[model samples]
Target chain A: MGKVFHEIRDPIHTFIRLDNDEKVVISSRQFQRLRCIHQLALTFLVYPGASHKRFEHSLGVMELAGRVFDVVTHPHHLSPEIRELFSQLDTDEKRSYWKKVLRMAALFHDVGHLPFSHAAEKELLPDEWTHEKITKHHILSDEMQEIWSNMTPPLRAADIAKLAVGPKEAPELEFDDWSTILSEIITSGAFGVDRMDYLLRDSHHIGVAYGRFDHYRLIDTLRILQAPPLDSKGEQSREPTLGVEAGGLQSAEALLLARYFMFSQVYFHPVRRIYDIHLKDFLCAMLQGGKFPTDVEGHLSFTDNEILVELRRACSDNSLSTSELAGRIIKRQHFKRLYERKPTDFQKNEQAALLIKQALEDKYGAENIRFDSPFQKGESIDFPVQLKDGSIESASSLSKTLNEIPVVKTEYVFIKRELEKEASLWLSNNKDDIIMS
Target chain B: MERNNQRTILLGMIKSLKDNKSWCGETHIQKAMYSLKTITNTPIDYDFILYKHGAFSYDLRDELTEMRADGFLSIEINPSPYGPSLAISESGQRLYDKYRENVSQYDPNIDFIATNLGAKGVTELERISTALYVCKKDNIFDIEECASRINELKRHVTIDLARSAASDAYKMLQEYEKHSC
Candidate 1:
């Protein structure tokens, strides 16, 4: 028989191996299209080395997910309670099937990226539709469904979709306990391999150290242990969840810190964020009806390559209506910072930057300003931690470092480049007044 | 639902859960809200999934966190290893008082959930609620089939316990339907 497994070199994973079934999926047009989608959106504009594609990042996620699956499902890794609860861990065949399904889910997770990935995702998509929704559409498409049907046990498209998007992104799918655990391994708020890979891979490509953490220690210590209840009323009945052993507390802390540093320093950098705004403006003007097509073929028809071509054309030719917007991307004449969020201002008004932006929009004309903020939703990192004596507790109560890590929030208002000096001075003079009023 | 309306329902639910002798943890609110929304068919819409061992809503969890940040809720910290429970602060109480009339319509729905599920721990709540979720979502009314489906969703649960859970859920559904708003 021909070799069933193929290996691809990855900067983060070293060598990512895939089986024949996965090889077929990877070679499909749907998966190949991800190669043209930029992983960090227009982040490369600021950090030039960060021009990596989602293709390799997805492979890295698959590689890491496979490792995590092995570690968490190994006999030694299974606690007696967990083993009793999930007999699938004891059943060799079931475990094998889930592992394969998980790797495939990880590989196909990002196949729905629009041209510039997440840069313009929210504004460009139709109402109630997101990249994750698009991913579900792609996975359920006829061509991909055929590949799933041909798998040894025939993987379900719905199953892959649940794991790929998790419960939050794909609310339509129902996840049982085992599916929830598998999905958590890929998409958990605390230690999902998807975040693990992107942090490592992004750090490696962007030449930054903020996203580095000890994955080896963290992975080995992963356990399906019960978490402590919030009160004494349910003290004895803890909920089983993905957690780490006492030994891995430091590694877990490092991961949280790494994410904070990356969000503050790299991912939410002012320049990088403004570029996303510019890209969104351009796409909104260029795409038909100010919306990208939700249909599979229509969505897959373009990527960053096509966007860049259009961008170059618009930059050279002044006839295009969005020529000015495209120039912001090609010529690096993007928006300049007029106001940044301040804690003091936030004390006066929680929507401090927003208030400032509204005031400035009135002053500078709404067309010359933009507002953007990184994800500020509640993304709690606290999880269960199993002690040496079989006791599980919340990580926040045990680890001081984990308890102290702050949620990263960045809010910015960018003005046209020419108005930066005047706007900055004016805002500096009227900053407090803007926030209070 | 409007933000104030959701908060009023949340604060009232928490207060009722406490009055009903529940621990009033976030899970208590989550499962109760699942019951409130799914069972009562109120206008409050939250996407709940069978997570951990029971129904969980990330949006609800985040809302609680957001409430805590906004001073509408506070974590009543406990001694070591025991997780903290949430309590409405003075500001939250004032807001609840201000919006008392707006949330009065949900009193019966809140009372029904708290009376039924308030005192139960996470494990019991999970099993019973999962059974209820299966019966409602899949429209599986037969006890044996419901038990079998629950087992498929939750393998850690024994067939006997699953059967018991399904029976309890079915009885509760019948009672709720008989007096549903």
Candidate 2:
């Protein structure tokens, strides 16, 4: 029988196709664990429809990454300089080898995300070990090694791991030029498929129009170009990076603006932030005994559903600290917003804002007053833009719309809903002191 | 000063270095800032620690990225041998001038360190910064002790290279102290 390909129906991408090798990867125990892990993590508490899992997102990223690779690496689409370099990978065999690598890298990028998806990362893991590090660990583990060995060409685990995380996170590992270019397709600062998938998928699930963008145009215009070397005497062997043709500039802007709006409107919604704080508190209390798993088997033992189950058990006991926090989330008794400093106010009166936080924390118990200053500024939107004349410039430089949009930073002070009246009275009297410079 | 205020001061320092035509790569800028803080007791709190290069600050890197996005700075990537260079733009100079008065307290420190360490290559700058970081971290002022620590921290550096780095660091510290007096 000819090679049978499997298609999984998806809401965002229409359908995700998996070949035999990809089928094995998807069927693996580690990959299957994504089904129980939430994509937005506690976001569903605010937007009830946003209960999408990472499993489908991973498939979407893989499908999008494959399309991107096809467009970027096509012989006809490359610039003259890049085309010369790509000529070396002329054969269908060589091209197919790289296509599989990129698809697998995209599929496994988020496999290492914790149960709450970044909510409990800083609280649980060591300072140096991020979700990316854990992802790398899972990729190179013995189980993954066996999976790779079973493939026809036998993929290199290191190559996939390197793409899953970027060069900065995994500085020790070295990648060839082709691998570096391919990895950029999956995780580059400019044209990464991970963000592309998440933005579209998050928008679809949350029922918001803010995250919608012309990703189709953006992907279709993807091209390869080489930036000029800075040193005058240095050799002109600039590395090829993913760039978008001139026509895609508007689409790129739309995509970036969508990211900003989603962050401000949906992701950083006051209700969602409070729920995240509560969920984080519950996880910390529940996993205080170093119960947060590190090994693959241990990681598989816990997922979003597992955490919810544990929280339910804790709520029933009424003795665990998780009971109070988890009960608040379960019962919809979220913390009340006592005070908030908008981005403009926080910029001018930062010191005064701190004083407000200090005064409130002193009045209320420290635990009762939660200060939320989400790091929301300085989103990176810089990417190489290929003009009609075949010259490369940064997207930020080329597009005025990109430069005008300021990064939004929101600060909030939350008090227990029971003490909302007292906090509101205190804030009214001290509002001048907090807002004034 | 607040973080945004410190960022203004940092941009001023970078502008001053650029005005003097001595601005180099990110590493040189980081070491220069480290020297300024240690010598003049500037209030810029980056919480730098000994990392791969020496006296590295991830916070400072984030600030640089912010500055780059704000059109205050630009990073130029050269070919293989040379590292990426950091340059202050015209708007960066304008912003620096706006906050020039606020950062006047650290002017002497910034000038001395930038002028002395500015022209040095990447290797020498890394060695000097690593030596100073080891000395401060271990509280070892003695040249030989600092050199030994540098050798331990950086496995590739030979005893001779460590001694040279230690000597350079010691000289810079002495010069900074003399200037402060």
Candidate 3:
């Protein structure tokens, strides 16, 4: 009686609906290829239950987008153009289409995500390149376009895909805005759907209680306020703005708390970081040694299994005694969870990095010492929230939870046996040189 | 200083104390004045007599002397009684608290919930029940017991409340995982 739609039961979002275009996209060989992509990459090595794929997460995001659209567009008189999009839905079919588009967006959101997730990208690429850029390329590639051709309003598939990633310069559409939307779909802010979905989803999968929230009330409170541009001595620029009422401030507050709890409770968990670091190191070694084709970098078409295969091969070839280790990790045999400490001051951090680098070089030699600063640029985009006063503010400014929500910077000293015995001594001796948890 | 400039100076002073965690004596004040010029990229006068010193000086002790007499802050002067050695007044603490309070209000619960619940109607006890089934292993709970609780609470609470309570219950069970361990 509520709504009869094609609902794909998901761990994050209970049910993700597939639109006609989304269905086509999802059914496509290229889109389905995302099923092989793990959302958190090598994070599963840290949190074994984090084995969910980008495909599943994308579906979750799509479902979340549909929920956002419902809240943002309804209760207020929607513009005719916006209304036209939803005109056909007398039944769930109409609703299903919206769900599908969002689903497709969510699914492909991380399609360009590298092997072992962000870790691989951090190790391999320069600072300027992003997973989103790769995602855009794959979506526009011939294989995907061929599949996209079958979608309803197929002509817009490319545009939407382009919209999802956005451009560097201030093109017709800013990547800032689209990326903002995408980030909202993924990260937790006042009203980010990604946070919304993951809170419930991660809680469900990880068997934790702290990630639950009032999902529907949040949707109802997504108020849209109108605002004018700052052009003086010209025709009044009228643009309808988005906001959630001050009364909904508590909901926003609750969201920030949940994000903090999740981070403390789940994401930044020490075991997860270690697992990720090992996977990252393994992949980097393989890529650096030219053991695999660089085409993987270009296409990035490898699945979780393919990465594991290469990792296993590398361990064997290097006489690394990591074959059993690789098998356990690939098979979800995970490590014990450890600490999650808030980051220290920025100056202290830089100083710590410098000291750690020096210590590593002193003990393990420059070539052997590898320091991976995972907090590279463009990692966490600020979530923008429309305040009660109708002005858009960055979530960090609005919420205190993010004030010291440490930018994940991991410094790992891969200790071979020769240096293993000295590693503890070096770490103890150089405590002031590095930021300890 | 003009009111705006004075306010800015006061805020900057408070921030310096908060971040640097040190008392701004004469030497610290001189250093601050120099650094402020560098940071602002502006040329400003550094010599000004603080009322407490009853004369112009480059030392922060002079400024603190005048500010204290004006009640801008309350401080315990050194044995020389020239400048404050430590402690901020109620007014300074008020300014510090304002920023601190604003920053401490962040909560991610709403965002987490919204994205996870698809189509946004999963709020009532019945809906919560459905969602519960999806989140949990099929045979983990005694469905009958959960349903009875839902029925009893159906008239008393909103769906959101129901979902929250049920979620908490589930979380408690999961947190105390006996079988998996």
Candidate 4:
């Protein structure tokens, strides 16, 4: 009999093939829970088509990671210097070992996300506890450990954990140089397969062209090369990192620009932001005892559908603050946008926005108003672009278009819909006092 | 005992900055502390890793919060182009003076770091500290190798900027060697 492999048809990646190991992970109760977790949370309320779940996204990431791994590790694709460094892993067996590990890491990356995704994270979890930390916990649990023990090579839970969270979060966790390169395949700041898959997958589901990018060309040009040391006292030893050839610079630009557009058009939509705040308020009230679940079992019991059902029950009670927030969402009674300031007016009119929020809050009550001011977007785009002449330069220095993209900051004052008229009139009359020259 | 030492080192650094009449932002403090520990070989244990800015320590952040609550420090969120600037409080200074004697052995190292790095802006400090961090992490001791590593780690930093950071880090290391001798 021919070797049988499990295959799932996906809208984004066409088909995601799973070996026995991957299938074992997918069939686990923890991984299956991701099906009920929405990829974009309440974003479906705005973009109705964005109802995709994390299950498909995890599979997509695994597939993209595999593609990138194959491209970077292939002898023909690697630069001469990089090839020499990987001489020990030259054999097909060693190559497959690393590939399997990368695929597994990608598959289990999002198993720790809480209900409603990022909306409830800040309120429900402790300040330092992120979804990545929870994911690491789950990866090291008895259930996952049992599965890893049964594998042919017996994968290390810590290795998978380090890759899932990346170097920024898991700085203390040590891994070998080659493993670091493999981990970068899934979680690196630039050219990570997680972002690559999400950008394309989110755009496809949201039915928008804003997040579309030349991922195919970008992946084809991906290569591994040593980055220069930071000081004279630094080691001269070559440390491999993920980078792209000069031909891929345009593709890289497209990927970054797509991220910027997606944040502006979809992720940070004003209505979406307010909905997130409401959802956070509800979750915070509901899970008041010790914030979030401390263990994997407590987390598995909660999902997107579970939370929605609880919200519906609370909406009928009317006594709870959670009920009031849930009722507004259920009845489509969203908060009114009392005032807004665009990026251009932010520098001159920030005080005006703040004063208006304070004045309106004093009159209407603090519970009825919220001032949302997001951090200014960062513009430091850093990625190595290997020139045709075997030299490398930062992509931002080479592309003026990349440097020209603006960092947008939007401030909004949201009021309860019933008090909108009074708030609007107060703002109109106090315009001179609120808005400073 | 180790935690106490870490706290003492932090307080001593803050006192040094206070003496210089200069306040720093969170990023500046983080990088400066990293440089101090690395250069002096002090046992001020803080797990710093390469973050977006450079070597960042969540432990240091938590410690600062605790110090603030205990009235040992104050963090003012005055708006600036870069971000908020953090300053030492009068109470913080008193605490530093009281505990600074505990870490007198490393006072020269702290003074060296504060005097050299105290007045620099957050961005330049980030570059230099990150340069030191990447060099140490990669075990690359050559100037050109260190600059190359930094440029790779921080793609936004130009080769020229990386070289400057490398030279600065080299000079600090030389000073540290001289002091140790």
Worst 10 residues of 1 chain B by lDDT: B75-84
Q: Which digits, one per residue and each the tens of the lDDT, describe model 3 over residues B52-157?
A: 1111122243344334432344533332102223345655554445454332221121112222221222122123433243234234255445444443323223
Give fnat (model 4).
0.04
Candidate 4 lDDT over B1-181, as tens digits, reads 4555667788778767657644465556788899987887777878788763567676686676555534455544332111334556666665556566777898888888898887766557767887888778888778788888877665556678788888998889998899779
Number of the top-ranking candidate, with DockQ as the measure: 1
User: lDDT per residue, candidate 4, A318-366, as tens digits?
Assistant: 7776778788777777898888874333334435677778888888999
DockQ, all candidates in order: 0.38, 0.09, 0.01, 0.07
**Maximum-lDDT candidate:** 1
lDDT of 1 by residue, A1-437 (tens): 79978999877877999989989989988889988998998898888889999999898888888988998888887777777877666678888888988999999999888887888688899899989899989998887889999998799888898899888888568776677888888877689998898888889989999999999999999987776655566335534578899999999999888888888899889999999888888989988999999998898898889889988998888988999999998999998887777766765666678889998999999999999877545456557788899777777667667655666666889999999899888988998887878
Off by over 4 Å in 3: A1-5, A75-103, A125-128, A166-190, A226-242, A288-300, A313-350, A366-422, A426-437, B1-181
The better candidate by lDDT, 1 or 2, is 1
Question: What is the TM-score (0 to 1) of chain A in model 4?
Answer: 0.92
lDDT values of the candidates? 0.82, 0.75, 0.47, 0.75
**Candidate 1: tens digits of C-alpha lDDT, residues B67-130:** 7655677765456575556799877887788788987988998898889988887667777888
Worst 10 residues of 3 chain A by lDDT: A228-237
* TM values, all candidates: 0.88, 0.77, 0.55, 0.75
Shift in Å, residue A358, candidate 3: 1.6
Candidate 3 residue A434 Cα shift, in angstroms, is 9.4
Worst 10 residues of 4 chain B by lDDT: B76-85
Off by over 4 Å in 1: A1-4, A87-91, A151-154, A234-239, A376-378, A424-437, B3-24, B39-42, B65-77, B87-118, B139-148, B158-181
